[model samples]
Target: MKAEQKFMMIFRFTPNFKYQPTEAEMVQMQEQWGGFIGNIAIQEKLISTYQLGFEGKQIAADLSVSEGILISENKTLGGNMVVKANSLEEATTMAKDCPILKMGGTVEIRTITPMGN
Candidate 1:
């Protein structure tokens, strides 16, 4: 039987604006999230994981130059993830453990299509 291929997974998260988690709370949250992803990794379902910073906070547009630049000195409000899976269903299933859901966050999963499609 042929082995299943992996694909890049991107998770879109919207934090609960009502409750802001402190640094310590964020650490705990990260631990739980890591544990969840680690479990999937053990099953050979996850290849990698990442937490993306808030979009707006990361990008700064220069009106004079009409260009966008990355600004690392800002506070981020949201996060994202990247994973590998055989199919969309698998990715969706792996996303079930995301801690953001408990705090009213949302997840968006999409497959990364290779080049030359």
Candidate 2:
């Protein structure tokens, strides 16, 4: 059996990003996202996925907390999904179909290292 590893894809997008699509367009995009994730689930690769809420707070190094604001175009973490794959390349290939990419968003793939006992 092939060794499998878990990866987390961190999604980021511009705070000003907006989708002003028609009803049909909206439906199409929704279907696309569903299809993309559904396929992975069928393959037993999808672990979990969820959309992040916009309202959040930020903590500074000094432990100062403030309302979360987009510090940069790619600073806001929009969402994330965890998946299992045989390799980083495979995980990256899987993330290529993420709907966020079409919205000018970014996905940062990182391996989920096992915790030391």
Candidate 3:
């Protein structure tokens, strides 16, 4: 039988508090998940991994843009990862170790349905 392909895994992070997570906290969180990520990488299941920075920090002020009245703030949903797996169950099992969830973070797992070329 043909094996099921891997899919995209999205992690939604929401701070328990309104403020940004402290550097130490972020480090701790990453450390907690480091083993899991490493395991997946070794298994060649991890396709890509990304840790998003603070959205508020990317904002820029430009007087010519909108008279400094209208500002643009880059808002991101959260961090994400892509993995190869035989089934959603396998993917989910791999995601169970994500550290974000320990910090009250949420993860959304979805399959990557490819479009015909």
Candidate 4:
């Protein structure tokens, strides 16, 4: 069998800063995310995952810093996941269960590559 390769699934979504989810809704979302990650973990394919915070600083070419997250085309990166898969198709199949898709978000899968020595 061929060894698995690592793929990074970058998650993005449009922010609704004015909206606040209710406690129950938050719990439901947590459950959904938990189940999604749990499923991948069960298969031993999950490498790692992360959720980005809203607060951020961006530096420009002139080294000037700006506050807040960057949103392009009405979408901002929400999170990402690294997983082991035989091919991009398999990784995509795994991402199909992502809860973000239900909320009109996107998951972009890219192969992981090493930096030169």
Candidate 5:
């Protein structure tokens, strides 16, 4: 068996502050996300996941702090999931079923690297 490696799935999507999803839509989204995560959890590949709140702060190279999250290229990071896979391709395959993609979002899979001294 191939050794399992840790990978991070970065989810990004376009933000629309003017429009809001209805209660039903919210419930449906919850189910979709739950199913997706559940599948990975069943395989024992899921490590952790996080959902980003819209509110945030950004710091500049000059040590200046700014309000609000950065939305570059019309998209902002929505959340991320860490998983274990045999390879990047395997991790990509797992990310393919992410609910965000159906919502016009993108998922980026990257290998998890530890800090170097």
Candidate 6:
């Protein structure tokens, strides 16, 4: 049997996001997210997930901590999901159906290397 590796799917969006969808659209997106995650859970691939909040504090290089979501356009760091897969290709194939992409967002997939390697 092939060993399963962990992958983190990071979701991001433009801070100044344009074209706010209607209430129905929002609901549909929410349902899509649920279905996506639910399918993974059913397949026993989901490890964990999180929804990042807008409010956050950042510690600068000088150790100066600043309040608020301190990041650039690429620093939105919206949400993430951890899943187990046999290879990067397999993990990426699973991420192809991500609803974030449909909403003009991005999904960044990163393999989680275990410590003490």
TM-score for each model: 0.61, 0.83, 0.69, 0.97, 0.97, 0.86
Clash pairs, candidate 4, are: none
Q: What is the lDDT of residue 82 in candidate 4?
A: 99
Which ranges in model 6 have alpha carbons more than 4 Å from their true place? 17-21
Displacement of residue 88 (Cα, Å) in model 1 is: 1.6
Error of 2 at 82 (Å): 0.5
Q: Which pairs of residues collide in model 1?
A: none
Better-scoring candidate (TM-score), 2 or 3: 2
**Residue 71 accuracy (lDDT) in model 6:** 62
Which is the winner by TM-score between candidate 1 and candidate 3?
Answer: 3
The better-scoring model by lDDT among 4 and 6 is 4
The digit string of per-residue lDDT tens for model 4 on 1-111 reads 788999999999999999999999999999999999999999999999999999999999999999988999999999999999999999999999999999999999999
Q: Worst lDDT window (10 residues) for model 2?
A: 68-77
Write candidate 5's Cα lDDT for 13-79 as tens digits: 9999999999999999999999999999999999999999999899999999999999999999999
Output the better candidate (1/2) by lDDT: 2
lDDT of each: 0.63, 0.88, 0.71, 0.97, 0.97, 0.88
RMSD of candidate 5 to the truth, in angstroms, is 1.0
The local lDDT score (0 to 100) that residue 10 gets in candidate 1 is 46
Model 5 residue runs over 4 Å out of place are: none
Candidate 1 per-residue lDDT, tens place, 2-115, comes to 456555544444444488879999899879888987888788676666665434322326633323323233322354555666677877887887777786656767767678
